[model samples]
Target chain A: MADGNEPRVFRIRVRGSDVVASCAETEKALIALEQAVAFPRPLPVNVGCRKGGCGACRVKVLSGDYTTIKMSRAHVTEQEEAEGYALACRIMPLSDMEIEPAFLSPRERMEMRQAQKFAD
Target chain B: MSQEGLLRPGIAQLRVLDMDEAVKHYVEYLGLEFVSKEDDGRVYLRAYDEFHRHSVVLREADQAGLDFFAFKADGQEAVDGFRKRIEDFGYTVDDVPAGEMPGTGARIGFTVASGHRIELYADMDLSEDAPETNSPMIWKTMPRGMRAQRMDHCLLYGPNIEEVEKFFTEVLDFHVPERVDMPDGAFAIWMTVSNKAHDIAFVKHDEPGKLHHLAFFLQDWNDIGHAADIMTHYDISRDLGPTRHGITRGQTIYFFDPSGNRNEVFSGGYTAYKDHPTRVWDHNSVGRGIFYYERQLNDAFLSVVT
Candidate 1:
């Protein structure tokens, strides 16, 4: 759902699902998803030690004009930067892009649910 | 069914300093709940609307690194079995009583390969039943499929790769999935028996303490971006890109904590469970080099060696 005044600028594809929006940056894209689309479930954000030091909030920028902000070199290697990857916490999308979340799987989710049931 | 070799341990509790800071970070940032706090500056935190006493423990300490802790074992027999295996290697084992900590039950003690003190025990009286609160932010705006299962694994920086690897594989029964080699013929290994690529990874650090980073698994890709947005709102510095590793094909992002410890959240690691007698590669083999991308050295990594 694009606001009439907002220009139809770029598109973002998440996990093979294409999402079109007028938002220009990655942050805006996420906000748009929250407002415009119905997600299957609630997402978890553990932005622990937000200083890019914690790596807990990392996301991959598959395609976009994104740049990181003051990321520590020790945390990410030089080889990692060139391969079209940017930290979601530090990355600000300058253009339309696609990004992927790391480490989420259906089987893992089932295990978690089972763990919760056992705990209960 | 027999539960012979199952790692059915849940997080007993993480002990950290500064209850207020820990609470604010884990609860507000990570979406965990402050189940309870004590006057002694210890805080217990839980995740995923769970009824367990606490998944992480934050306690007051002069230093802010990981304090002593334990993982849950299935039962008394499992603890004894694990103890026999460890003691056969000539490491001492001790028995600690429950009630010393709020959520912890009975426990057996041993040291990890990285020389960290660890406890293995079972039958800590966990709260039988608890309700799941529909917290406003719990399930909204979630990625297509998002559910944090449990504390998946921890990565440690070890100076001696062979020593640590042997300790885990031989003494603790951890399986090695992949080992990347340094150009100079040394090895950096990732080991785990769980379905995920590596429950615990060991990287060669110039120094002898925990150097690399700690990682947790997420159930959804969208949460990665959402979590990043939350970090930006807090004005924290970002460390690295969310790149896919050539070796594991696992996507990863790295950052630092207030104390400068590195943490990583990665997904989609290739599993080696089916391949029971997995092939072991040489430290200088070509296959090892594929996963890691060559990066320009920065001052931080350089400083560690210098």
Candidate 2:
């Protein structure tokens, strides 16, 4: 349990980029990263679905001390979770960590590119 | 007046699809009178209203769905009513400091029933505005859809459908018009305080957050075809149709914006009220044709990885 007194440190890594920031609690870290980064879109961070059931938001922790809210079977598999993949939206960072976001596929990239061209 | 006591009244307008093509198409073909263009490339569009300036804003982005926008509550009292109800349900509300912009009036902050951060303001002062250059491809030659009044509703994607639905209905006091339960008994809730069926909805999905298409209601159904024809002329008719949704009784057409975000131009939706208690139904209650529709991305259009 977090005591709210002990100063915590966190090092976060966003996917497809090397920008990282360190901050005090998990929420502050997440919010700070959100404000600092110019994301291609709003990163789908977790709301309250911390249990991982909602899959509303998920991020993989590359290296860190963390815990996930209970997940639903439909959202994630035990094997996936076991493979160092934790939902970024659900887990509270306990210590310094690294993370990887499951990015869009190549074909999806093409579509996005085409859409961007049209917009421009 | 205490800022915490104020609730943003009704949705002013929602930014649907961030694509350039979609925004341009709406401006040129559908007859959405262009309002202003921001230096950051954000374009403001509006339908003529008795009260305010442009009702909707379309920002250029790589990903689609409802992006950020504002809401206008009835009065200071309504804003206060929302603040009380939100805190009563255990959530944080704050007053957005002034001078963020020149004309925007006193604005407060609160999360929506669905947990999205939103800003509410009263007395928007856009008195000294300038006109923007008109696009060459104006749809003056063709008929158009209902002059959309304002962006009124935002249908969001919620992976944990049940929890989100509960947050909106119980916490924020929105009326649930219809609920679709999954085979496992989880549910997607449609809640609204507006006369329209729902100002917001919680959809069940695999990926969560606001990764769904956002819509704006045209004044009438004919405007739908007008907008579609405009897109067709632009050679950008990705998709168009009149499909019904079981949850909110909305008839809609799905199309891509220039930025690859999905946008819907809809009309003929119902509303919820306090006197009429909300109705709930079983999961298998509605037909698949009306309730469930295909959301195919064709791999090429998928841009953002979240």
Candidate 3:
């Protein structure tokens, strides 16, 4: 919900889900999502330090114009950002948006499976 | 036996949570000299006493862990030899061309049995600001922070300790100075290629490729105290220590970087010669072996990894 002074409805498309949440344009995309339920369940983005240092909350801005603050070079390389990846915690929503949170890589998936087995 | 082969631990690239906080911890607090920041946002740092262009590279990332650890071979031939040996040990080796990393030459990299990326390279440009070689003053400049002498070694946690032991000792010519064994098998091993007690250590864990801590060499016990004072002043989240490790006999302190990666500053391990007998510890006495003074492991020591 946007206040009268800032009543721009931003449609945030998370992952590949058709469900879109109507959110007010905000400085941080993550904060905007937190205010509105965009998915059936909580978004799976992992976050650590929220100050654009950890790349845990990184997502691909599939089809939206957004601005971002300076982020760490280690997580999102220049090439990655150029390819449309943005840290949700650092991005300012400017228009209706579509984002896909970075999914686990193949290596990570294997590790997760192994870890699950160990835990069991 | 070739006297000239693997010379020393050379490079370590760590994924940090915040660049600013990481810089402050590594530079202002740990006494490393800032070298340069690449366009990719990675910052290079070197200790004041080091001659290499840089030793540590910090990449701001979401998670905290080690990216890779590398050693300097005597020359290109030694690196080539290790590559062949490592490949023969049944691991794929990747050739990284020169200039892939600033100031470094070609390197051969492989993932060891412990699920850690290890690289061997033979060439790096000397730092222009390295301590003066000719008529050098002991005080090249005043050392700062805890006055860390060098990036010493790291302890990594992963599965398959027995395989890792064979890989380092049989393939890489590293020698075990100490090891812990349980009824199941070897629990942990401390290995070295040089005179230092251990160049790298590993603990048996269910998960692969976890960093325990990267240690920096401090001058002595007093320096460890100074480090503790600085940590307290800055309110750094301390994990353990200002205590002695019965394993290496190092006066040490363990603390966390803002991103939750553990960093250790330690001093005073006895010199390890290749001929020294391997010290052994059993599961029952492993706690005392790890922490000599406490004689018991801290709750966090065994569970924490980044």
Predicted candidate 1 versus true structure: per-residue lDDT over A10-85, tens digit per residue: 6655654554444544354444443445543433322334444333434566777755664433334354556654
Q: How accurate is candidate 2 locally (lDDT)?
A: 0.52
**Candidate 2's error at B226, in angstroms?**
2.9
| Candidate 3 lDDT tens digits, B147-215 | 998999999988898999999999999999999989989999999999899999999887689888999
On TM-score, the candidate that comes out on top is 3
Rate residue B291 of model 3 by lDDT: 87
- In candidate 2, position B36 carries an lDDT of 68
| Worst 10-residue lDDT window, candidate 1 chain B | B297-306
DockQ comparisons of all candidates to the true complex: 0.08, 0.02, 0.06
Candidate 1 per-residue lDDT, tens place, B1-306, comes to 332443533553343324465566666666655567777667876655354676666665433445444556656787788888888877789888886667678777766555555677676554433443555444432322123334456655546777777766776666777776656644577776455677666666543444355455665556666656765686433455455555456665555544345545566767767355544455455332333443332223222210
Per-model lDDT: 0.53, 0.52, 0.82
Ranking by TM-score: 3, 1, 2
Identify the candidate with maximal lDDT. Answer: 3
True contacts kept of 1: 0.17
Lowest-sum lDDT 10-residue window in model 1 chain A: A40-49
Per-residue CA lDDT of model 2 for B200-290, tens digit only, reads 6655544444434556676566666676665567644343355556556666666554433355677777656656766665645634423
How accurate locally is residue B166 in candidate 1, as Cα lDDT from 0 to 100? 78
